[model samples]
Target: MRESPIDDFWVRARAAVPTLPAAVPEAWAFGATATDADALLSLVLDGTKTGTASSLHDCEADGDALPEPGQLSVILDGSDLPRAVIMTTAVEIVPFDQVSAEHAYSEGEGDRTLGAWRAIHESFWREYSQDPRGFSADMPIVCERF
Candidate 1:
């Protein structure tokens, strides 16, 4: 089988950061579409974005483990190529409506306000959530800081 790009990226990353774990960590893009992924990745690379949020229902539906502090991740760009590595600095679960303004600012999206974050994330989850329940104001959100 052909070697995956993530594997190659992991090898180089480990070589550069010898303190990294021996095993490869999870790799994923930011948003549902390629454009979104690339845009979000740029924010991360520029130090503008430091946090992200996800749907708890979607995580459970997908059988993905919840992120924990100190867990490393490989962030992928639009083309599914690894671009940067990040470590989870914190994780909090809260209702969509209760997400903090500080968290929203850390997300580094439009206006970096809670209102914009809610609007953007609500629209995103409504259309792209993996959970059958889709979007709801009371839905649990996984707020993560990297």
Candidate 2:
């Protein structure tokens, strides 16, 4: 059987970090599209992006477990190649409209303002969200700080 890139990446990452678990964590990219993934990943690699948000409805629908503090994740690029490993420092569930400006700033997108964050996320979710629930002002958002 051919070894996946993620498996190979995990081997290298564990070698460097040394403290990572023997089992690899989940690997994922940032956004719906390759372009979006690359752009968002750039922010993360540059240390400008420390936070991210996801639709709780989507997670539930997909049967994915909620993120928790101390969880490790492998970040993939637009091409689905692992680039970096991140540790979840915090996770909060909040209404979409209630997401804090501090969290918005940590996302490091657009003008780094709540308004920008809302606009960007709203549009992205509306267009790309897998869940039919889509975008809503009061929708539950999983805000994660890593």
Model 1: per-residue Cα lDDT at residue 77: 99
How many backbone clashes can be found in candidate 2? 0
lDDT of each: 0.97, 0.95
Residue-level lDDT of model 1, residues 18-120, one tens digit each, is 9999899999999999999999999999999999999999999999999999999999999999999999999999999999999999999999999999999
Which whole-number lDDT from 0 to 100 does residue 145 have in model 1?
100
Task: Report model 1's TM-score to 2 decimal places.
Answer: 0.96
Point out where model 1 deviates above 4 Å. none
What is the Å distance of residue 108 in model 1 from its true position? 0.5
RMSD of each: 1.1, 1.0
Global CA lDDT computed for model 2: 0.95
